[model samples]
Target chain A: MIKALEDDLSQTFNIHFKNHDLLDEAFTQASYVNEHPHQGLKFYERIEFLGDAVLQIVVSEYLFKRYPEMPQGKLTRLRAAMVCEASFSDFAKECRFDRYIRLGKGEEKSGARQRPSLLCDIFESFIGALYLDQGRDAVERFVRIVIFPKLDEGRFDHIIDHKSELQELLQKNGDVEIDYELISEEGPENDLTFTVSVIADNQKLATGTGHSKKVAEQNAANMALQKMRGK
Target chain B: MIKALEDDLSQTFNIHFKNHDLLDEAFTQASYVNEHPHQGLKFYERIEFLGDAVLQIVVSEYLFKRYPEMPQGKLTRLRAAMVCEASFSDFAKECRFDRYIRLGKGEEKSGARQRPSLLCDIFESFIGALYLDQGRDAVERFVRIVIFPKLDEGRFDHIIDHKSELQELLQKNGDVEIDYELISEEGPENDLTFTVSVIADNQKLATGTGHSKKVAEQNAANMALQKMRGK
Candidate 1:
């Protein structure tokens, strides 16, 4: 069973772990170890701790070089979004890495096999195991193949998180209260178009229309960001 | 002047950088770059971001292997202390790496050179430079010589209950990883004797037998303390 797992994993990862024990440890969940303590198997959490850091550096270096003129604050925010649980979990599923996790009967019954957090940890632990077995170059090669393409496609830029960007810009010098209010709503209950206007320090900025209030506010924020970028 | 800086750094760190630009960037403070924008010379902030993550992963893996049985929370706390601003800044000054920092005229007037935060950032940036130029093995060797000695000297922050004193002693000035595990349980249900062992930095320090689990842990900690006093 484990041999088949290794075969499939190597095909997907484009590399084989020299130390198979580390690879097994990376996929083993704590719940599994708890259920089978006598097996003397380790779990992924500690390796996940290390891999989280590895991902951090790899992403940081990539961003630092990719956007050379970008400021440190912006780089930090982009890196956070790129390495976030949502991002890695999505990448894990995309790579079919989710098929290999070894959960205990309890966790399996609880339907934890598909949990985002678990998937994220597995992704990180796999990186850790790869780093230990194959070194950083191999890890970089894996990421360049698996993650950088998605990154280059701007898939992670919803990270642009416009509302927060607006808040950060407005609050750059001092604390300023920003509010968004639904200025208008039209059409039927099932298909209403809401308009939202953003106001900062009692000064109105921009208004935008969307299918929902949240979407309308985001659009409004986007308009304000465009203004900031231009004016 | 930059060449002299590199020579001095190579002497202290015992590794020469192949990419002098990165080495310069590592030591180049942001204030200095702002004063000389056309120099096309970058500052430490971006690389510092990478270095900070490198430091985190290196320290994390070190703790993970050193205290194989320690829990994640304690490992995290210990890593934080080791990599915190207070800790690295002292290391930077100890290596006299602070002497090489090039400050802007304004920053020099304000005496920013001796700032602990600045020194901390330099320490991290230097690590970043080393990792990029010489690779992880060289970075690990650098840490083994420069940082690990100070760590072994018991000099950072401090922490004990029976668990905590065994912890405090093992931890000394800084926090260390400690774990307690049940080794044995024997005899009839009502007359069962529980044996617990205390582990400090992944080594079994002592074990004790008692009627109750808590009593066994307390006795185990006490015995560990006695052994420490003797040795």
Candidate 2:
């Protein structure tokens, strides 16, 4: 089972593990270790710990360079949104990690492989194993290929509610007044499109149109955030 | 004031900052920014954020390589002990970071410079600045010169209570009975030393002596931990 999964991972990811044991250990659940006492199989907890640190640094470095002008708070928030458990689970699903997980009979019956937290842990453990077997370059390459495309797809954009993010960003500058005003309404009431404008310090920052007033306000806030971020 | 501190830091640390502003920002408090609004000075929060991730990765990498046999949980605990507020404050004081810190009149009057939290923030921010001005290698070098030596000095050893650490370690490997037995007492009652032996699974692992029974037990646990850690 371990060899088959290792082969699948290599074929699917286009990366070969020098130490197959590391790869196997990355997928091995704690429950599996509990059942196989004499097998001396190690769980993925340690690798997960290391991989978490690696992921943090890699993402931080990427954000630090990509957004040179972004404040540290915003950069930190962005990194958090990108690497949070939900995001990791999504990445794991995309990589078909569920298919390769090694669990005990109990955990298998309980459907532990489909768990988001477990999947996230496995994802991080895999990165840890890859780092150990290959190197930083290989780990970075893996992240870039498997994860960076999500950035382009704006998968994490929804994680940060633009309205709240904009508000927080504005608050950091001082007690600045921020107002989203309804500018116009188009079409009939049932299918109306609302235009909203975001004003920071009485200056019109940006405007957007949406199907509803709330969405229009959010879109306006998103536009304002982009403007403030100098994007 | 900033220039003088910058010179002192450069001289003491043997590090030349190409972008001196980054270094200055690392020590600039938010209160200082409030006082010098027209000066457009940046605070250390953002740099501290980046520096924090850098520090974690550097320390994690160091430990991962240094103790190949150490379990991940222990490694995590060791990293936490090393990077905790107390440790960072100690590092900051050793570098005389208080002298370089830019504080508002209010904070200065209140003796905020000597505060541990502020010192830790500055220490992390300094790393951030160093990473930005130079690179990972330079940041790692700084940590190695200033922080790694402390590990050799046994400065962080006391941070983890040996008894609890040992219990946690033993619990990870399944259920095991740990017993601490008082072996002997020496000297008069008022100034007596107690010797204790730690037994795991009825096997005496190590013995320790201390002035009090609790201390003796702790010392015995520490000895047991060392033996188990293969030190």
Candidate 3:
């Protein structure tokens, strides 16, 4: 399966991998590693990390100039909607990542490969592999041609607006007024640091810091979000 | 000035500002109030808010389909860079927002229009005004025609990767033990909340919450990024 995948991808991406382990890692779930450590199924966490940034820059540049009259906030929201986990999961499903994913016996039986979490991670890892194998151009072209078109046609299909999600999280199940507070400041006056605390009923729900107060608040709000996910 | 400005804009946008106040507000800086209490210059905050969402959705939809193979992480960073205050300021300047801005005597003397913060706000306000006047179509067209082109050009520009910045921040700050921890949980068994803390030197440097632990940690790590900027 590894050889077949490398053969299939090599022609498309125009790159050859010296080590099959890289591609194998991209398709290997963490569950697989826990089950068979001797199988050497490395997880794709590192690749996901690299791939995440690659996608951000490419998509951002596309949007920044694509909508010249757009204000910053709208652009930010749009980007979030387009690039979230649900969307990634959908894309991964379209690519049939579940079929190729090397899952642990438990995961395979439980259909964990189709889970949004694993799917999104594997998709990101695949992107990271492409980037590592052939650099930004190969990765960019593959993304633009394969992934983006699917996302555009299905913009609202699996999209989650972070602000809307955060707002809902604050309103639901929590017995407090969720407020974002700027807790600290640092850096030069031109570029400042803002530490924001997501407080529910005056107790800190979560706190995050960012370059701007809004960003810090958003981070804290997102923390508050995870604190209230399924509830 | 209102009529002349309207004439000039109408030539390009084919849109008219029914109330000149909206136009004025789009260009006004809060600093206008400092010098002239009676000078009734409405600041750009409201318009900035509206424009922010408009810009986001437009860019998001465009990007979602434009780059199909790119991973979520890279897409996010790119969007941030494009929608950041600095880029908005640049866009506002390119649009000559300063020349049209209605400033009080003090702000005018202080070159408030040229100020990045004020310009960024005004840029948002302009989008807000467009949205209020013409709905999404008008705003969308303006974004597609004006804003996106600039971003398209930025495709050639190098992007700053935030996650890598996180790693560098830890290394530079000499925090060998910097890592993310799961702090709390919420939600049902199907979906969960994960609160993550970024710790260094056995102290919580920052905490972020998200629907998933990965997102929570990313949010936390990004928040921790404030400590590294300009350092």
Which candidate has the top score in TM-score? 2
True interface contacts reproduced by each model, as a fraction?
Answer: 0.56, 0.67, 0.00
Of candidate 2 chain A, the 10-residue stretch with the lowest lDDT total is: A152-161
Question: What is the per-residue lDDT of model 1 for residues A80-100, given as tens digits with 9 covering 90 to 100?
Answer: 888989988988888777788
lDDT of 3 by residue, A1-231 (tens): 667767756675555776577789888777878988676456776567666656665565555544333445566666676667887788777766667888779878887867898888888888877767667677778778666665334353233333455655456444456677778999999988899887767777778777877667766765655565432
Candidate models: Cα lDDT each: 0.80, 0.84, 0.68
Interface quality of candidate 2 as DockQ? 0.55
* Alpha-carbon deviation at B231 in model 1, angstroms: 15
* Full ranking by lDDT: 2, 1, 3
Candidate 3 per-residue lDDT over residues B1-231, each given as its tens digit: 556667767886677877777787777666665566666555666567556655655565455444433345565666677777898888777766667877778777877768898878777889878776676678777777666776434341245333455666566535577777888998998889899988876878788777877667766765666453421
List DockQ, one per candidate, in order: 0.43, 0.55, 0.02
> In model 3, which runs have C-alpha deviations exceeding 4 angstroms?
A1-231, B34-41, B151-231
Compose the digit string of candidate 2's lDDT tens values, residues B1-231: 878877876798778889988988999999999998998888998888888989998898887765555677778889998887898998999988888899999999999999999999999999999999998999888889898877645565564456776777787769889899999999997999999998888989899888888878878887777677677
Error of 2 at A51 (Å): 0.8
i-RMS for every candidate (Å) is 1.3, 1.5, 10.2
Considering every candidate listed, which one attains the maximal DockQ? 2
